[model samples]
Target: MNKAYVTFRDQKSRDRALAVLDEFRWRKSTLTSKIAEAAPDPIVKAPEMPVTLSFDPDDKTPVNEKVVKSTTPLYNVTYEEQLEQKKKAAYSVMRKLGNEMAKTNPELQQFVRFHKLRRKGQICEVDDIKASPEDVC
Candidate 1:
């Protein structure tokens, strides 16, 4: 039922509404308290080992000397280096295209320069490729 009685006019209706609200509040508080009381207590920690049994001299061992070499050259360049190379390649291509466009039409020189300068820094840092240039603009 909707608690908001918009059309209630008489004094009796208002008194009854107030009583209902008080009962609702009382029931909510009691329910919350009961739930909290029934909740599980914080977990207990395990006991620590005795001093005599804690450490052993025999447990200490030298590091392994064996080394394994891979046959494939797959990891010659790391993922980060590869991503950097790709970004550099992309920006280089963008610069070349902008240079050509500016040369072909002198009217577009300012626009091409704007495009080139906008992507001067780490182009790969931005997630949105299209908006990267617009951001600088």
Candidate 2:
């Protein structure tokens, strides 16, 4: 390991980092640190505050009901209820996504007919042409 420059969100954090670095001991060697001598041309900017993620009861957006139910306290839920919720969630996801995907991608809809024939043993496998890589070096 060589040297590293660490940036902190606040001066307190930077001070703590410097203190830790100053007396840092690794293996049988002790490490030393020093403050930067010059200020940067454009001083480093602190990172933005993280997005607040508190849920609002008034929000109308669709939510995964199963997720909220499953994450509840264990004592309030049963094994059978959890299993049923999982099955419903899985089924709804697959049904919705599959339909939307088929509607958006024409090629998927084209393959649907072939898939039906394949399931009925009306389609046969064909060998794909394999191309050998050409060395251009």
Candidate 3:
């Protein structure tokens, strides 16, 4: 049994294809087809305009063997966003620490108890860690 799904940019093309394919005799067998309703949201979206870049071997640009690239973020982030990202990462690390401390150290249980209680703020909480008191509140 052969099965396939198709999508066209317009409804006219879809209708035409379905009309041509539906109940048509092919290789001594009849074909079954219908206009399938597509979901409101596409499974994956194609970029409006795609750019495909490839390395050029023929173009001679002298490759420097001892060149060091700059260690910079690809996307620009505001100070508040950066701080929030760091806080989320710190919370993840703290949760892992809490799990290990709970199992490994009974001596630190009394100290860890306070942290565990306050975990409602630390665990899974994403907030700007370096914001002013007024801005944070």
Model 1 per-residue lDDT tens digits across residues 8-67: 588688567655655355534521111112344444322343345444567554323111
Whole-model alpha-carbon lDDT for candidate 1: 0.52
Candidate 1 structure, TM-score to reference: 0.33
User: Alpha carbon lDDT of residue 56, candidate 1?
Assistant: 50
Off by over 4 Å in 1: 1-75, 121-137
- RMSD each, Å: 21.4, 21.3, 19.5
Q: If both were scored by lDDT, which would come out higher, candidate 1 or candidate 2? A: 2
Ranking, TM-score, top scorer first: 3, 1, 2
Model 2, C-alpha of 131: deviation from truth (Å): 47
Backbone clashes, each candidate: 0, 0, 0
| Candidate 3 local lDDT, residue 45 | 50
Q: Which stretches of candidate 2 lie over 4 Å from their true place?
A: 1-75, 110-137
Q: Scored by CA lDDT, what does every candidate get?
A: 0.52, 0.61, 0.70
Error in Å for residue 112 of model 2: 4.7
Choose 2 or 3, whichever is better by lDDT.
3
